[model samples]
Target: MSLSRTLTRRQTLLAGLASGVMLARPRIASAAPTEFVMGVNGGAAYRNLYNNVLRHFEARHNAKVVPVFGSGSELLNRVLAERSRPTMDCFVTFQGAWLVGKAEGVLEKVDYNKIPHIDDVHDFLKDPDGYAPFVNFGAWGIVYNKDTVRTPPRSFKALWDRAYDRKVMLGGVYHWQIHLAAFAYAWTGDQKNIDVAFDKVKELAPRLAGLYGLSSDTQSKFQQGIADIAPWYSYTAQRVRQLGVPVAFQMPEEGGFLYPSAYHAVKGTQKVELVEKLIGTFYDPELQPGLAREDGFIPSNKKTVLPAAVAAELPTMEEVQRCHHWDWALINRDEGAWLNRWNAEVRRLVRG
Candidate 1:
């Protein structure tokens, strides 16, 4: 992961393909278009992404993409369940789920050479073990109702204050780990301390509104006034604002946390070429900028630049570097024990 080495290699590989896309070998016009399946979370934002950014990739590859949309865990289970003969060719998900997939034998150790984007991506975003390369990420932090809370919150400690009683909400399952990691780091100076998180969730339970199961649930609660403040990613915050709720997001005192998404070929699938093509589409300098403009995501491709106005609204590269790093592999290993403890102590106590 040396910067000097990456730069030297990038210069050599990018020299020959400077003018055009480094694409998969061209598909024959007479052959039936290959149908490639991609797993994604189903929702309006994802649907918009498919229509705007992904469709072009499909066209260029002469492939018909069939997206199988579900939550991160659901998609992981689907691939694991279908491991013998994978109906899905590519698996796309967040870090936590990817960790599980890697441990459970559902994912392959990706060939970095096959994924041309690996060189263009920020060094931190590429998996050193080569499971997958992160395509994009959004910083997760405090999202609060502007009307109720006149001032912006500065720390994770703010969520536990009696000031927001019966008003706090946090995102989907994987988000539970993000929330846990933040408080764990704040209290113990260790993000891997799930024990601290378990204690904090219980301590915050009297005030806890809900542990949301989906982004839609958070949007609905924010719209209906059931949640006054919570932890959410930039995109989910935007959706809450679209619901006509006056919500604002901030990088908290503890700093924003990183939750990234990546796509890799399923272990037993025969669509490696198409999967590599999809990853190349993510790294394409010309096309990668659209994801930032359309979805507020921070692209992994270093060459992808955001418009001045759009860049102003999103977290800067400096802020992205300072965001808290997640120990997803540890979380995935302890998830079973943590969930059991959470249900025993924290779940039944949540009011919403």
Candidate 2:
């Protein structure tokens, strides 16, 4: 399908109301309420964490939490669509989504005084104005079926190798592709250096099995023996293992990109106190540690202790610290141009 046609259809259904939408009116209350809603990534384990740890606070405060599960983008666009109506009280998303939301004026500054745990969080995670605070760090790399490919690809170069032609795959529709493209460019020390990145991809074109639409597609393809390698999030590596799939997740020797998910209060949300309470709950040492253990994300607050097994398996703080960082702000500021150029160049290489 044509790109414009696809976007127009998405816009009509999901692009959300333009900036012209009126602001929502905050609900008034004499004191803290007993009920608040939170939007989070959809998953059973995450839901369990909220029910076991965070809900304890709500019970202590005589309040209740309602969770609306979605991806970061889904939550952001939903909040944006309901800008005038304010359907969500607190929205949890990645740093990129939160920054974009803050820039769009859809988020409200969190009062640091209210969330005492703010003091425990690392400086890099907290926004100056407190509009959104990061919850955890995540890395991007390759996930492959260990049983299928004995000599796994060590780096991005392996994905393009002639030996693996028509056996490689990647999650192309989601943000992993964005991060991979960004990483490819960043590795060249040229954020806008599409030519180099495209050259790399073109070299791998002969090995391309197909582009996938979802993370599950990558996992599924690998399990069915359709793909030999797929680029994915570090967290997914653990989840894939839990599913009884013998998968090997690798961080390229050249280093991979990392991103963080954040929590933000929607502007004019009625339950400000409730939102603050929920955000504060996220930083609770007790909760943060469990989140890290269960979700496979590095905790935002350094105080949270990860399980020994999990810590041993995942990348260390020092290792994460050593990798080069991609400038997410620049990417957010110019994603359209980058994607456009990426598409054109990739198509040129593929068409050849």
Candidate 3:
């Protein structure tokens, strides 16, 4: 061939080869999976612990977690409000509110096949309905500052003691229902029948320093010595103590209340499989112990072996066994009515 024609043909062949290589190259994979939204209880301790787990989960699955923190009731409200166009993928709530959420049909049934680690959860903590699975548990009891209170009160009745007048604090409406039930159980031997409990709370209202709505507020009250004694969760008490507060937790002789907090996949989440995997992480035996230690929560996974310090600070198994676990289903059935009564009658009686 002529030299010019040969050169043209060679250039054409090279251009065609380059075009073919470019066409064969794969497009960069679409962006990583969208972040999952989780609604969780609000508190510095809880936020820190959840963030740690989320970071680990994100790294492993190439997914991100966006945590939405609020009180259990507030989170439940958010889930219900957004039900038609669900924004949150998963929810973590205390038992009372979890039951309410379940009753409201805002949660999806847990698919055990997708979350195999759930098989390792303690049978007692499992949800019979398979909707919400318990992740951790904590006890509710009297929390007092050792330096301020010369003698620690030993029973729920102590709130009514004349000495504690205007020196006690109680959690707000929904949260304090557990305390009210405790008094009813102590006074009538029945948590479900709280008529007497209402009267008891009314009597003690005059003595209460105030009704605190946020955990942070409760903690601040105790830290500032504005409140001397109050009803509080043991896990939270431990967290406060770790902060160098002089707080101490005591289970009233009438018995303490134990509540199991759980995780539920919000119905209509597009990330069902990913949500299941995230829930499974909560039950990972290896991870549960560390989370339990950090948050002062009792791990739900039976295989979790907590470190010595964590175990020592947590309630003994026997103590937990003896603690009263409210029939949240029954409570949920009438929770709204109870809250109405509390707002109308009980809350109005708060001294200030």
- Per-model CA lDDT versus the true structure: 0.77, 0.69, 0.79
Order the numbered candidates by lDDT, best leading.
3, 1, 2
Candidate 3 local distance difference test against the native:
0.79
lDDT of 2 by residue, 3-100 (tens): 77667665765535432242232233224546667787666546655764566767756677778988888999999888887878887787667777
Report the lDDT tens digits of candidate 1 across residue range 1-352: 8777667776867865653342433333235678898887777767656865579778888898888988777888999899887888887788888877887788876677987666888887788787778877888888888898887667777888787888888654546766777789877889877788778878888677877767777777887888778888875675456546788777777778887888878898887877777877877877766676666677778877778976775778888888887787677677678777766777777777
Deviation in Å, model 1, residue 52 alpha carbon: 3.2
How many backbone clashes does every candidate have? 0, 4, 0
Q: Write down the TM-score for model 1.
A: 0.85
In model 3, how large is the Cα lDDT of residue 66? 83
Q: What is the TM-score of each candidate against the true structure?
A: 0.85, 0.80, 0.85
Per-residue CA lDDT of model 3 for 253-293, tens digit only, reads: 87788877776788888777777787777777877766766
Model 2 alpha-carbon miss at residue 126, Å:
1.3
Off by over 4 Å in 3: 1-34
